[model samples]
Structure formats: structure tokens, C-alpha cells
Target: MRLETRDLAWSDTWRAARLLAHAYRDGTIWAAAGTVAGWRKQASLTLLYLAELLICRWEKGFALGAVRGDRLDGVMISYEHGERPTPWWGWLLRSFSCLFAGPVAVARCVRISNDLERLKPTEPHVWYAVLGRRDDSPGVGYALLRAGQARADALGLPGYLETSAGEEQVRINELLGWTLRDEYVLRTGAVVRTMWRDCPVKVAS
Candidate 1:
């Protein structure tokens, strides 16, 4: 399968959102709270992702896509040191947008955010906010990971990401050189793992 990586355009936001909604439909923290199914839930998830895309764009962060031919099969959203911890207004907007998923889902999302914050790295790093691949796509996830890591290396910054995908993602991160920093159980009972990857130290010849 031919895979091409590029910066995601504003026009591609909805398409990427749909891909993430379906890709995480059964396994993400959203799914654990029943917010990954149904039309309302899907719509809310799409809006949430769209908000994230816009936030990343505003921060001059990376919102990348891995396309297989004309289809966007994978997405990776990340922000460098000074760009993360999205501003208050962004969170407020995200929470408001998620209202359509119902109170329970919104509350769970908030709690998950809190949990992630508690586990975040104390030092400056690139935050990999979201990484996902289409259901039928294979290997694209790793490609997306590499794309984010490449940016982190270029900036000479460590990388951080929290995953609710459990062991599978943990193993992938490990294979990609990330170390497990911590794991916590969210209020919704989903276990999230935070991983870290130090930047490659350049050595003198």
C-alpha cells in the first residue's frame, strides 16, 4: 500500500474527523463511555476532533495525515513545548461541542483530560494529542507515529502521549522507542498509559 504524509488542510478536517470517529469507535476512552456510537455521539466526536484540529492549527502545531492514494487513512495531531495544554477557550469550546454526546460523555471527557494532565511530563515536550488509523488500514498507524517523531526530532524535543488503547498502543510506542512513564485509571474505569520518548542526542563526529 502506498502511503503519503502531508499537512492536513482545513477542508480535510471533516474527513479526518470521520475517520477517527470510526477508527476509535470500539476501543478508545470515548467508546468506554458509550460516546463512540450512534449519530449524536459520532457527530459530537467529529466536532471535538475538528476543534482539536483548529486548536493545533492556531498553535502552529502539526496536524498531519497519512493518505493511501486519495483516502486519508491515518492522522496524528501534536504540539510542541509552548503549544500544548490547549488554551482555556479551546477547552470550553470542546466541552460545549461535546454536549450533544450527553452529560455523561462530556463529564467523562473532562475527567479524562484531568487524568492526562496529572500524568503529563514536567519538562517541556511535544504532546501527541491524537493518533488514529482507519479500520481497514494496516501499518499506517506506525507511519503516523514516525511522522510525529520526525517533527519532535527536528525540534530537538522529547515527545509525550497518553493512550487509552491499552497494551497494543503501548507495545507500538515501545517499539518506536517510547518508554512507559505512568498509567492511571480514569473515572470511567478505562486505563490510560502515558509514554515518553527522549529526543535523539546529537553526538560530535
Candidate 2:
């Protein structure tokens, strides 16, 4: 199937989030809330809310998708540092939406997010909040990575991401010149690897 990377619109929030939920169903970070009953359902709802906030409300955020016809094969939600601020209501919206995901899920997700944030580099760089592709969308991950790296390259900034998608992903990032910064084992014994790519590499689109 032919695939093209393009900015996803707010209307695609549910679709995109559902795709992510399926791909990252067993991911390290989101699975922190697994102790909760119906954890997968809670996680899906949480992703819906988070996707809404990022795709529609967050000023610094943007989402890219690998698409074919009407379906999304892959997605990368990202944002730049020190660029634009998230509106105050954005957090309120998330807090309110978390009600559906339950307090326990919200709390664990918050903790994981905070820990990952603290572990990341404090430099100005593009943050890939999440990246995933369907099994059928072969090589979609690399295409999205190239597009993301190109954006950082154009901005004269670096690229940053945390992944628990296992060794294959680590190798993919390394192949693209992204350096593994560090790996932190979460409370659940899940290992999250933080990676960084130096800015301004020439990319042939």
C-alpha cells in the first residue's frame, strides 16, 4: 500500500487514538496503570482524552499520520519545547476527561509521564509524545521517524523520544542516527529507553 505522512486533523482524534491503543496495548508507560481492573479499557479512554488535548488544544502540539485512502496506518504525536504554551483549560479538560478513565489510571499515567519528563534532556527539542504503526503498515515507523527528524532538522533543534516497544525500536532509532541516552526501569519493572538525535541532519525527502 502507498503511504504518505501528513498532519492529522482534530476530527481524526478517535481514529488515531484507537490505532495507538491497539499498537501500544502492551506498552511500558501506559501499562503502568495495568493493576487497575479493565486496564485496557481505561487506557483506551485515557488515550482518547490525551489525543484530544494534543490534537486540538495544545498549542505546541501536532500529530502526523501515515495514511492510505481513509485509514491511518501509523501516527506520531509531537510538539516543540518553548514554542507555544498549553492553554490553562487544556489541563482542566484532561482532568475532567480522566474521570472516565478513573482516578487510579489517571494517577499512574501522571506518575509515568512525570518520571519520563524528568528523565528527558532539558534542552530545546522536538518531543515525540508517541509513535506507532499497524503491523500491516510495514516500514511506516521509519517513514514517520524520517518526517519527524526532518522537522527537527528544519528547526535547527534536536529530537527526543522514550520508547518501551522493545529492542527492534531501539535498533530502528539507532539506524536513523538517534542516540540512546538512558534506560530507566519503571516501578512495574518495565524498561523505558530515552533517545536523542542531534539536530540539522540533511534528509532527502
Candidate 3:
């Protein structure tokens, strides 16, 4: 497939939401590890689908992408800037998140969110990347990673992403020289692993 990567605009949000939903479904075991057994029904799934948009896309310094020759076949979303000393805003958001998603759900989300933040390097220019790949192909995933990494390098920083579900993705990260930083077992027995990777090239002067 002749694929091209571009920065997402407003028109892409709706389609990107759909793509994210599909990605979540395709990786359901990964997305809802602890809650899947309880919230496998339509309502829970719907709420969760919305949750992705509310938390992941709504954050600042986020990038969303649709990979295709002309239209979007797959989508990638990421955030670059985040708190280093302390995520005070993140803590506040989690408090609000508990109201919408409930306390237990909020706890799980906080754990996952914190892991993503910690995976980011301490370098001044580093930005955390939260990536979801639906098509399940290294070609597609790597393309997204490359595009995001290029943007990060352009800004004179490193990029980071977390992969918890698929072994194929773990291999891909290894190929790209991503290091495993941390792992945690969710209440649902899903094991999540955090991964980090520095940009392959230096930023242009």
C-alpha cells in the first residue's frame, strides 16, 4: 500500500475516533484487561470508546494520524509535552476522571497513564507518546512511530510509547531499539509493559 503520514486536522477527529474504537476492539484484551469480563457488554464498550477520546485525544500537545493512500485505514494518536517534576494537573484530571468513570476505573486509568508518563525520557526535549495500532502490522506501526519520532526530533526531543498486548509489537519495539522500562499486572491479570525509544537521528540545526 502506498501510505503517507500527515498531521491530523479537525476533519479527522470523527474518523480518528472511529479508528481508535476499532483499534480498541481489535486489541480488546489489551485495552480492557481488568474490566473486560465485567464490562464486555455494549454499554461498557461504548463508554470506554468515549473514554479514549475524552482522555487521550483531549490532552494538549496531542497528534492524531490516519494512514492511507487517500483515506484513513488506520490511525495513531500521541501526546508530546507533559509534566516532569510532578503531574499536578494529571492528578486533578484523575480526580475528575473518577467522577465520570468511577473511582476503581479511575485508579486503573491513573496507573496506566502514569506508566506512560514515566516511560518518557528525562531529557529536556523528550515527550511521551501513547500509540494504538489497529491494523497489527509492523509496517503500519513503524510508519506511525517514524513519523512521530521525526516530529519529536525536529523539536529537539526524544519520543516514547507503551505496548502491552501483542508480542509482535514487542518485537517491533526491540527492532527499533526501544527499551523496556516497567511492567505491572492489572487486576484483570493483564500484564502491561512500558517501552521507551530515543530518536534515531539528531534534530536539524
Residues 38-148, model 3: lDDT tens digits: 333233433444444445545655555646665775556555554333245544543443454455655666676666555555655444434555574446667777777
Predicted candidate 2 versus true structure: per-residue lDDT over 167-188, tens digit per residue: 9989989989888988988778
Off by more than 4 A, model 1: 34-37, 85-96, 187-189, 202-205
User: Each prediction's TM-score against the native?
Assistant: 0.89, 0.83, 0.67
**Clash totals for all candidate models:** 0, 0, 0
Using TM-score as the measure, the top candidate is 1
How much is the lDDT of residue 21 in candidate 1? 69
RMSD of 2: 3.3
lDDT of each: 0.80, 0.74, 0.57
Candidate 3 stretches greater than 4 Å from native: 26-64, 83-107, 114-122, 125-128, 134-138, 200-205
- lDDT tens digits, residues 117-194, model 1? 877877888999888898788888789889888888888888998887778878988999999988887656778888
Write out the backbone clash pairs for model 1. none
Model 2 score (lDDT): 0.74
